[model samples]
Target: MDMNEIREIFFQECEEQLAELETGLLKLNDGDRDPETVNAVFRAVHSIKGGAGAFALDDLVAFAHVFETTLDCVRSGKLEPSQDVLKVMLKSADVLADLTNAARDGGTVDESRSRALVKELEALANGEQPAAHAAPEPVAAKPAVAAAPAPTDSSGFQPIPFSFDDFGGEEEEVLMVAPTYSVTFKPRAELFSKGNEAALLLRDLSRIGEMSIHCHTGDVPTLDRMDPEGSYLSWTISIKTEKGEEGIRSVFEFAEWDCELDIKLAEEAEADDERPMIPVPFDLSLLEDEPVIGDEPHVEMHVEPVVAAAVAAAETATGVMQAAAAASARAEKKEAPAASAAAQANAANAANAAGQTIRVDLDRVDRLINLVGELVINQAMLSQSVIENDNNGTSSINMGLEELQQLTREIQDSVMAIRAQPVKPVFQRMARTVREIADITGKSVRLITEGENTEVDKTVIDKLAEPLTHMIRNAVDHGLEMPEKRIAAGKNPEGTVRLTAKHRSGRIVIELTDDGAGINREKVRQKAIDNDLITADANLSDEEIDNLIFHAGFSTADKVSDLSGRGVGMDVVKRSIQALGGRISIQSKPGQGSTFSMSLPLTLAVLDGMVVTVAGQTLVVPLTAIVETLQPEAAAIHSFGATQRLISIRNSFCPLVDVGRILNFRAQQANPVEGVALLVESEGGGQRALMVDAIQGQRQVVIKSLEANYMHVPGIAAATILGDGRVALILDVDAVVGASRGQSLRQEMSLAS
Candidate 1:
């Protein structure tokens, strides 16, 4: 490909490396002292620097070099990974990510921040203690020792040193011996196809020591028989380097499977009396008639003389050849067991990845899902037609249609599964958010996450980030009390926030809970009255007072800060969630803490719904929201006021809401005794008996966005096409209940009037 494409691939890899870096640093911060973790973090930064240097991204290269140097010190155990040190590293990771993003997207990072972090990193690298507060625990301070000047490459960037010395002192001495080896390498066509350049490999080999190479062209064919993509050349090389045979082998590690390679130690000088003489296998005159391939005809004829000279030299080196053969045999015998073990491990890995995964663009998956949705709709229409034509349920056409419906449903489900992903990455991001916010608020807080592997639709996960971020910030800034206050309240000095996710029924429920002083009810109630949101002496319940926080422009903070209380309140969070067909609620205790729970549909494309008729119109209620359906008896129905009714179920009273009246389907409320009552739980964990005219069969229906296609209906989540080709509105249970409560308050006020 062209340079631009290569640059794009580099950036893509940088993203993966950045993620790995963050994950490793987080593990270390959590008290995982594994040396491999530090190595991994260092490697990520090193790789980024190498690639950035190639692309002329000087800023990225410079910053990453310094970061990598500090990480190298930690990797080598020269620096301890104390909590204070980890904190600095985490911030460094953030800054590195910012630099990467700025480089990719055409922007600039804060120079002041970058310079300050560089100073801190350089200090740690130089073995200097950090600020007093960040100093490691005192036992006895070791005298500071200056680090050796790191070796630099042609680009003037220092490479992290790697040596066998780290493994053992004896191995280091063994690595110092200079040994010569002869290598034969023949590339297969696949090597070049995979973007592995032979010239680049040769250049890397040249870096180790001196080398002489001879190219063989025996495999090349005449132009008529030539395949442009075929491999037609091989190379034999002699090299002497201080690095061991393992180092030489590592130079071709990436291409080993794509080439034929052999290596053997070159022979040492022998005494004059022991020299063996060998005769040339072919006469020099025999090669003169062979037609040679070269850039010019004159040059092509010179190949005969070159071949003659090479053959004569080989004859004089018979002793060296014999020694190389012996070395080859010994090397093979020594490597046999290790090679077998490697082969077995590779087999196991291949078996595990037999069903390999390939990344597909999300737009393609979304298109497939849309097509499946259309198929579901058409299947429903066909089933309806078949039922109408074949009046008898036992008809062949009806049975076929039923089978077709089942198959279509399975296809739709499979398509949706392709779009489902775990929320772990998003949750990990929240941990960083918690740290940054805690630093800003000057509070000691810890965020613990559970059930991060809960899978949800990609669309839902993408939209959740913003609202979840706001909630996490709010929990740190407002939900948690100061460290001193927490201690005074007989709680741990460091407040804890627990974030959890789980699949409940057919919905994904996420909760953010904090262990700190809970909502102050009196403060909230008085604030509501002072803002004219509620009348004085309104007699609001504890739940109602807590929920007032979600009202538009509501805040308990006396002044606005960077984190919250700038007129944008929980109401925006509620609206955003609701827009995704989700609901959020709050529960608070006096001194314990508060929990914000959000329930959202698994997928927005299709839903399992219970069909019901209200005010002579068919409507759908999400099956997940329905607790049970019951027939209301006369004795079980009671009227508390002109418009308020309650239903008694299992000796417990629940508010009864007429669905038709709430949706404006009818001007007057329906009689509870004549309609089917659906006992359902609202967002706030309150039960409500929703009155519907009758219950119909349940079915899967494709959801079409009402707001996008038309306008937002107050109580309707979305519209769907039914089997009879009629449009049905899907009820938003939380919105309907909210409307019912507002209606009740209006009636109470009118009564007082």
Candidate 2:
């Protein structure tokens, strides 16, 4: 691949490292004192800095270097990860992400913001209290790379020489005598499970210099009693290499987190070196197959019995036998190399398959989804055609069609899952939002996120960010109380905003909650009146008052704040959700808290729907929208207002909406008693009974966007093709309810009256 492609991979890796950085820092903030967490956080920054330095991204490398240095202090336990320190590190992570994004996308970074963060990082590195809040003069821009830089390309990317200091020390000077060192490595189960092999690690180490490795197999149990997956083997090595200890450590860097490793000068670990160890020569085919450069080949000694015992012991303990029999055959150096070629080839292919991954273009995936959708529609059409034509007993064709339908559904589900990704990235972003908003509002706030790993389609996740961001901003700015206010209310000084996501009832639910002063019912009521959203004497319940925040043109704030109210208020949040085939609701307890729950479909491709007919026109209602369906009773119908009607169910009277009149499918409302009523939960947390002429069988249908092809209709969500090859509209239930309450159905009732 070319440098541009390599840079793209680098950027992709940067995202993973940034995620690790954020997760580790969050753990630190939660009072986790695990050393590995600190190391992971440091490694993430170091990796970014190293990559940045290679491209001579001076600004990025500089910021990441200082940030890494501050993290190093935490790793070494020279600095405590107090909430203050973690706060600065979290901000640094955000800046690092921004810098990386700018570099990858050719965008501009905020010099002022980065400069301020650099100051804080420097302060923390110097063992001083981090005054990162002060926007002091930015430190001078300097390349974090130490080695000489090569000539620059047209893209301004200059490759910097790789440095050995990252491992431990400089390797520029060669010693007269290679330094002898002792290494004791103990493998944990995680090492092998993570696709790391101790044999491979040993192979890399043996090439560094002249080395003798002794395998310890005393921990191994008998074959039947031993756990195949358990790690029961370890190795000790004595080496004299001019490359120094740094080179040795670099060999095992990938497995360091999964294994117990120790490296010291021979003099220091001489006592631990006294243990008896089996001479498991690194020259074995599996462990030391490759010939090391600069070393002369040794004459093979006829020590078959010793080699056999060692191979068996190692194989039994490690369980990493890529080619155990082939290795055994190769133990006799006189054996023909061709004897093991077939086995070796098969083993190599298996190894490659274990770690192979391919990155496909997202546009290609989208096209595949489109094709699968067409396949589903055509399959439905074919099945319908076959059933209608078959008067004879063609059970074979029927069985084939049944199998085909099942297979088609499987393919559709599998294709849609390819576009599914966890919502962690979006939730991680909310951390920064909470911090920035809290700073602006001058309130101490803590954000706790759970269920971030809940998966949803890429389309939903992409649009989800904007609305989720707005809600997070509002939760911190509006839902959370100030520090002093929380303290006075017998709560912790730090207000908390919690974000969670989960799959529920064939949809994804994202709930944002805050432990602070909730919606003030009286205040919200008066604000609704002032905004002309409701009548002055409107006997609104607390829930109704709470939901009025999402009413268009309504504002509880005297003036718009720079935080959540940057002018796309809760109303826009609600509209954006509705546009995504989703709905948002609110539940609040005065002086306690408020929760904003958004339920959205998993994918935009196929929807499970309840097919129905209204005014002789076919319509499909999203199954997720319908709570239950029932035949309305004549005794349960009651008139409301001058035009609207209500349906009484379970001692509760819910507004009954005529689906036909609301969509203008018919001029008059459908009789409630003669029609099927689908009880659906509306956007504002109220139930609406929708009257349809009849209930048809349920089926899975592909959603075809109307706005993309035709003009956007008010009460129509989208259109779909039916099994019999007819177009049917998908009813936007919430939109129809709104229309029924305000305009069309009431107008029809008035006209009929």
Candidate 3:
């Protein structure tokens, strides 16, 4: 394959292995120290090493080799997987990423950094004292090891060893031989002290045939400042050998990342030259044992395929047992297996055993969902058209159309459900963060997560990570306190950060609460006044003071700390949540703790909305924000001022806002006895009634973003296409009501108000 093809393969494999490594690391971090996870991590590194060797990418191969060695120690239990080990290993993974990116761009190896990293790896591999236990080793002076050979199994074909005396020879093979092959060599400036990696490649190639070396000094600068030991040169080699290109490529694999190299087969060869020979056919015998004779009738060897198939089939059967167990878990009694149910169970088991998770590109999933939403609109239009057609009121045709509409609705639901995934992964991520924060603060913190299985649209899940990270960090650094502080406050020394998620009234509600020092309202109020966020004499509620932390550039942490005292994380969380059509609220008690509750829409593409008509315009209010709708007599409305108003609902004066006027539409004077009042729940737990001309109906609307097509307009979340192909704005009820009052209700009730 050409260099470009090899590069593509390297990138693809690297990406897959990186993802596998990340997942395994996360599992390990979550306390899953299972042998499988360890083995998986090892396998990821091993595959990366193999791929690097094929591409003759020395930098990647070198890093993976060392990384694989360290993991091998862990796998063998010779080196304990201590937190320090994992931490260093994580850093090593980052270096591997750097090497990969650099190689992709055709850059020379970063020698200084590589040597430093290699020294660290050696220390880790040697099981030396961690940095905390002793001083770090100087990169140049650190002791070295000859390149370790790949471990031999029952079969031989041992990895070539590398040592410092043979680099010039290795450089010869890299340049003169293996010209048809592509070699990427990246050397640590200090690699010469440990191994003459280049010479080994030459020795390995001489075993096959004659080769030509072409050294290139393109990257070398003027000689004055150049360190002779540093690799200021790269090479392209041409070799004529019977050995396959891959065999020749492996010699420089370990140094691919640290040096620049290209190797390819020489074009012309002497027909009279003897063919290359191997002292021992290391892997040849293994291939010979399984030689293919014919498409069929090679039965002497192959019962294994049938047995493997049977084993897979049996695994699926076991999956059925698991599915049955799952179904029985939530049911009060055993459910009878109906025909369709049985088929579904079977299909599910087959799917499980097949273990083929359909990894759709996320873009494809989004497109599918969007198309389904359009289907829903078209379905609605069809239903509307049928109703309007009135074909002499034909009962059969009307009934058929209704059934078709129902089927279309079911299909839309099924498609949307495909995008829903349990929020367990995100919750688990936060749980890990909780542990990190606790360690940093030197405080006892136990994160208790509930409703991890609560499902949300994937789009919401993707955007949720940053906000959740900030919140968890805030809870750890600012919300919780040290053990001594907790003891003095009549709390458990091991403080608790409770993260709870659940579906509430068609929306997902996430609550992050901590049993530690709650928001210090007095301090917050004073800070707000000092910062001019409010006046000194302003009378604000405790809730409003708690929210000041969400204001940009506001932080209550008295001293800057590593986690979040610099005053730059929470406001972004608030804005992200709002951008997702969600609201965040905080509840706290002085000596107790604080709970931040965020209510988010279930899906970005669709929602159950209450349709209302006002001043010749139709608006859909997210049903989650609507408490109740009532056709109250207009006389019940009392004007507090020219614009301020209130309506008595359930013996309480709920604030009233005119939807038409709030949206800048022409307002009609209410017939003092008529008009509808829609009671809405504000984020602050306050109730408000929105006056509208009429309640049209309740239905699901596909939410289309207005901000995408136009700039963000307050009081409007998005616009939706109606059945008649007209556009109706989805009212952001919270923003509408808040903007009408010229301030957020939370701000209006601040302690400094």
Candidate 4:
């Protein structure tokens, strides 16, 4: 709508382009030699450079210009995209992102970082290996790329050479003479609309050699009839460069599809120049001023004499003739509206069939979700009211209530789905994090991500980065042994860390596993004792000992380091996960490795749950955790210890956990035979029978965070409002199951087996 709005849109597009750039570079790093990938990477930087030039973002344009050059070499196969090459490119992408942010938000990036990257990129383009760490020096300000004039020596001396081609070339003179080419680029409106700039294109051509560009305006229409979207401008460029027509055409490679581009040897196009044309030659001398040398002509006219017969007709105009003409004109105007309406209808239908989308602000979607949550509550309340007042008779009111329930649930789900987004961007950031950690620790590590496209709530995704990043740093710094240690342990020198996400039940499970020397139980136990977190003689299972690292102020590192030993990482990770209504667990092997698994809800807004009464207190068990509900018979219940019990189903025994006692709703365990047994699964591949007093039917309820609204309860995940407007606790199935096990979970599990 306006310049500022358009600039903001350009910056928004820069973010997408930056993401694509990183993705394509990562593909190349992963040994993908697909030509399209290289092309895509090149186009991203090129697009940024073009857009930056449009807004006069000099630093961005300069850096992207240099970055794009190296990528061009890679795209054209002039330079091989080896591991080292990609490493440089990845860092360059980071710098480019910083530059973009700086352009948008008004800040400065590290001059040293940008300057060093510029030098390395330049060296790579020149077919030289980049230094591991190039020192930064005082570099020129980001230049506004345009048709730069010929270079001069440091002494400011310019060289002048004369070509004697007209008199026939001598052998010595011909060797020094460069071939010339003529290029005509007439851009359609698509070019400008798509963020490509004509000035930037001409500037790219100028890089090849000395060039003169002409602005052709003969096709421009008069102001009254002119279309703002029309394409009436064209450019004819004449250049003499050492690299011939091939080099010249490469400048327009990115724009070939959106513009009419033709390139040929200068002599081949000499005949076309003879046609009479209005050309405005661009002056390259004034780099600080506009390149165009003339104002645009808005209108043109041609004069002719009026005929005598026309004047005679006007003097004798009749009423019948005027009436007939008016009627005819009115009829023509009346028909136009019907045809126009039909065309508009057809366009609308085509768009609907295509299923196009518009971007809505996130705050609006959030408001919609809140409204939908209110709608769900109201629907439930209405249903509850009808059940209490109506008799056991069939009625249309009952049927209508059923229909309304289904529709409301669907609307809530649809609204929540709007906030769902892929976790790939976070995973990509983790890759960068891995790279940074690897550099810091000097460890040869490979990060493998799976199911990065798994979609989750945007809120969950936003908070996931911190915890994921901490885990990644721990995996690299403490989980993975150094290269020499890995080799000594009969493992690959480069340790592998695999991060994966998948939907399990109704939750998204993210597991981070590493291949290296696993957790050392002896060291961990010793550290726990030293930190006074556990008694020296305390007996703990391997799982318990391994989990000690998650305790506050506990670190197994021999000495303090930048990555760890601060005793805050894993604990912070645990707390952050807990804050999101998620649970995390750890499993480790002596020599193999360790795996940390996190289970989180798909959306924090609402969840399906089974409403049950525990010790006269209403509680909800998440539907996702329940495998099946069964009534435990006296024959199936058996006591393992004085207070421990197990329920046998289909020849398998699962621990029996009383929801009432576990949640402190009652002082004693509930009767298993008289009540319903919910067979629920936990994240660690364990099943338990949760005993509840009575079943109150299943319902979808909006999740209000207990910790946020009130305080955290050990076995209760969150709080929700019931149809009767009573507050009920949502059971944290994993926490309850885990608490039932206590220290004897492993021993009881072994006994059951």
Candidate 5:
């Protein structure tokens, strides 16, 4: 295509390489000393450098070259991947990523940081120790040094020579003999159609060394017989280069199946005394005397002397060329088994990938999901219409509609599955965030991740990075204590933050737990009082004290630091998670540790909801949040004060919240006896009995974004269209529970008054 498209592909591959580089480096940091891992990391940097040079990205090329050099030392065992070294390498990786991004998008990286890292990398590569925290020196601009010289328009398919120096010792001493080879290349019509240019291949071939080329026009037809798309041109090239046949073959690897190629060693030059001097046809004037083979045209050339001499030379070299060919055949036979084995392994890998996955444009998948959502809504409407028209449930139309409903649900589920992706990449990104934050805070922290392969909807995973990053930073900044403090508290000097994800009850649950001094309850309480969030004598349980951190404008830090204490993150974290139809809660124990748990919906497109009527309006409650539904007995209902009510289930009292009242559907609370009690767990792990007017059947419903099309309604996650074509509000269970608690507290104060 165009150079811009090629550059875009190059950058996309750079991203994949960057990910691979980070993954390999993280593995090394985790104590994996596998030699292949280092090689893979080095290859990633090397590949990026090679491509950058092709595009003349000088800054990227220079940085990647320096980074690759240091990585090579580690790969060759000249440098050990000690903790200190790994720390520097990890920082260097981040800088490399920044450089790559800057190259792709017009931006600048922190030059001072990159210069310092380059200095450190150079020191490591030279087997010299670099001073920690050394001031960065100015870096001079460097020209792009490509791994292989770029081809010009005149030369084609230049092969880069592979070095054997890395093998070391005598292999480096053995100078490869430059061998002359005769190459015949005839491209098929498909070659040019596939964007393979003969001139480009010739230009690359010229990079090897000196070359002599002969164009054969004997196959060309007259104007009347010529076909524009037909292949008529062929070339015989003679080249002398130190690179082996494999290197030469690689030049044509892209079009191997699209052309006819034959390569063999050219005959050695004969001495003047050993052979008669023959005047070879070196110019077009000599071809005037040669007869062309084609029927359409004829050219006569007088080359009787040259032909006779060439026959004599060929006869003399017949034995030699035959021996060389036999030897080459033997070598091929010797390497056949190894080559076959490698081919089998690669084929198996390709087969596995082909069977398991396909790279599809995300926009296509999104469109498909939208279509499936529409199908689900249409099916629901049709089912409702059939039920309304047919009084008897046994009608054939009703049965067909039920079947259609089941099929639509299956299709929707299958479509959602296409958007589900494992959270490992996001978790891997968080690992880097943790390292950077730990370095900034001057704290020794280790992040341990588990169940990183747990799958969630792609949209959920994308939005989770922000909230997850905030939590991870908070864990390092606020939850984990300093190394000295941790040791003083009889804990390990290096604090551990455990990030885990798993599927729980049709939802994804992620937990970030830190092993350090837990929440200081007294400090939090006094801060809440000082901030006017609570009174001086406000009685709050430990759970309530822990949750006070999530309140807006809440912070317990004595002084603001770069990492935190601006009272900005925790509250925003809560709001963002709630907006995703997810819940975040805190669990802290004095002097032990604390865990922040988040529960999120599997997908934002649709949800399994329990339909219920509240204040004469239909509402859908997420089934994942409901533990059980029960009819409250008269004796089980108790009023603690004038307005606060509790439901006794299994001898335990749960705060009874009227859904209609909490959502402002009604001005007054509904009677507990007349409604069904839904025993649901709130975001904070507390159980509450939600009182609704009546229970309707459960169904899967498509979620429509109310906040996008209209203003966001509090206590309502989103709006959806029901089977009857009426709009129904989907309950934000956590928000409603939170609102109910606030109402209950206000009611208690009024009763005290």
Candidate 6:
């Protein structure tokens, strides 16, 4: 092990701790305050602080110390989380990320921000700042130590006394217990610098216990490859101690992060001492032909049947005497059934065993998806070849090829499933955002999540966080109304923000709805004009005006506030959704609330699209947006205004646009209504009939980002590879429809002349 290895462990533990802190934050603000959440927050901060102390990161330790103090107050119910407290905690999280990054980089972090946050936290803690520059009395400090006995050099196993088989595998276990209890502990990456040693701690504990040691050498590097500074070995030890649980826990009071330690009482020490003929060593280099404790011979006398019967009779007599001596014996035995039932119920409360979480290296999942994407391409080619060969009467190869195609398709689906993750974590994050916004806006908001287990690609899930957080906050601060306003409107005192996720038509749709005051159309329009997002006299539909908020710095907040007057968050949300090759739309009524729906492709690597030609240029349109394709008569194209082309489709007059003109591509003709009309529907309840040269059928295409290769082109969501190996830009139907509407309005005004 080397510095790089240590760095990796530090980064990994930092991520896990951050996730725990985030989950705790969500639970903290889940409307109902749970003491467990505060304890969780405290534990998370404590772990980080301990880890930082071991790494000799004074800045990190100091910052986390303050954070832990504040959380301790919450844990003890001395201070409930107010908006101010949450803000400080959020800043503390930011500091932790910075400190972890700094430690990994072998540098120090700026202490100014952390000090400011600590000052605010302390203010709330004591209702004032510590008496100006007064030196406080030092409290009694416990000896910092590793949770477990130190592993001998070049050993790999950490010692634990408990038989953990009864507790199940090494997954979720309660780590925070009262003090003085012993736990076999392993400190995370940087714990050694904190002046803690497993050996020293074990030695101190031997005052109360008889101890034996063994080291696991599996993780030890070769002598020539070993780094003196790195901890490569873990240990397993057997200890008999009289100290209560808290006393044992105190040994590892300052070292827990990144380390894996397990502890259990030594109940069979006598049996262990009597059984083994060979003695396990206390140090390494005696690894060859090491003592095998379980294989050693133990004396077992075979008893005659009569002798066994007599011993059994004596044991029965002793049992009867004990039962008769204890009056509570029968009562206890009577409660045996209930006790067993109670134990069974306790088992159920341990935790849900059903995949609470699964960890996968993201790079591996991405590689699998990339391979699946290539398979999809090859499958398309095979299908095409099979169709051509079948038409040519090659029956034998066609049947085999068809089977191969099906298997390949199934394999692709299976690979995609590996990258799918439930979006519950994302929804939970949104619940916290709602709390934040409610506090900021002086409103009451309750979050209700539906279909939280809806699965999507990891890539989509990653990109969705920012956008969803912003949207949820927007719904609370801007979409929801004040408590008085809600009460006046005969609504519940607490407004509801519903965050839902579902799969529809081969895509994931996330909807954030708020039962607050709906979008004030006049205010949005007026703000749009003031911000130069729209002309003062411009007449816009509610949908169009509502979208202006997504424009940078287009907030309708009357004044700058803590929440969102800064105006960067919503714009970021819109851009992030767009970057994921998704469309976001808003729907609102005057009195009712608003719904922000984001429809995202399941995977960014591949998609099903319909190929259409516009002015001889092939373009791919997502099949999800296409309702139907029609070959309309030329006479069916009617002019509502100078620029608005209307086509009668399914007995309704729908606006028609030349796809080439919308994309700013070369237009061969204006009225190509007889060619092909794609009846595309936008997310914002608008319909557009796009005119193209021809329909080239539907096929799955590999999606390549325009942003990766070139700048993002407006009206183009992404570019994909056609079957013929040509590049086709996918039409952003929503943006194109909006553009067409704008053009139609301008043309109609000109036509009045």
**Which candidate should be chosen as best, given lDDT against the real structure?**
4
Q: In terms of TM-score, how similar is model 4 to the real structure?
A: 0.75
- Model 4 agreement with the true structure over 1-753: per-residue lDDT tens digits: 344544565676677789899889989988999987986787678667655654557788788878876887676566899988888898899889988999999999999999999999989877643442121121113231222232333433221111111111111111227887788889886775665656556655655665555545456544333343446657676777887777877887778899999888888989877332221122211221211101100010000001111111111121112322332454446422111122122222222222246557888998898888888888889889888888874678889999999999889878888899999989888888888899899998888889989999998999999999999999999889999988898889988999999999999999999986789899999987887877989989888888878777778777898888778788888888887888899989877999999999999999999999888889999999999999899999999989999999999999888888876668887779889999999998488888998899999998898877776667778998888898888988877888887833333222112
The list of candidate 5 runs beyond 4 A from truth reads: 128-160, 165-364, 628-658, 661-674, 681-683, 686-689, 709-714, 736-753
Higher-lDDT candidate among 1 and 4? 4
Candidate 6 per-residue lDDT, tens place, 1-753, comes to 333333354456666677678767755655548766775666567666544432345666667767776776666455778755776786677677778788777776667767888888877767632444221122113111112132323222333221111101111112233222223445443665443544444444443443445433345443334333345545455554556655555665566564676665544333333221111222221111111011111100111111111221222222212322231333345322111122122222211121255446889888877887777777777767667656775688777877776787777778878888889777766755665566667887778889988999988998888888778777887887788988899999889888889998678899988887798889888887887767988877766777777777778888887776887777788778878877777888877898989988888887778988887788888888888888888777787765667898767898878878876676444665557888887766477888888988887777878988987677788887655556788887777786776634233212111
lDDT of 2 by residue, 1-753 (tens): 334554565577689889989999999999999987887787678667655543547687678767876786677566888998899999899889999999989999889999999998888877643455221222112222221122443432222112111311111222438888888899897886764656546655755765555545467665435443456766677777877878888998888999999999888888754543222232122211221000111111111111111223333333322233333435445342221222222222222232346677999999999999999899989888887888774779978998999999999999998999999999988888888888898989889999989999998999988888888888887788888888889999899889999997678999999998998888778876776767987776565577667766666676765653334578778767866777677888878899999988899899889999999999999898899998989999999788889899999899998888877788877789889999997655467989999997888899998767785666777889999999999987766875665534332222112
**Which runs of model 1 end up more than 4 angstroms from their true locations?**
1-6, 128-355, 630-657, 664-674, 681-683, 686-689, 737-753
What C-alpha lDDT values do all the predictions have?
0.70, 0.70, 0.62, 0.71, 0.70, 0.61
Instruction: Indicate which candidate wins on TM-score.
Output: 4
> Alpha carbon lDDT of residue 434, candidate 2?
82
Per-residue alpha-carbon lDDT of candidate 3 for residues 411-431, written as tens digits (9 for 90 to 100): 778877989987876876675
Question: What lDDT score goes with residue 572 in model 6?
Answer: 82
| Candidate 2: worst-modelled 10 consecutive residues by lDDT | 292-301
Please report the TM-score between candidate 2 and the true structure.
0.69
lDDT of 6: 0.61
TM-score of 3: 0.57
TM-score of each: 0.69, 0.69, 0.57, 0.75, 0.68, 0.57
Candidate 6 local Cα displacement, residue 591, angstroms = 5.6
In terms of lDDT, the poorest run of 10 residues in model 5 is: 294-303
Whichever of 2 and 6 has more lDDT, that candidate is 2
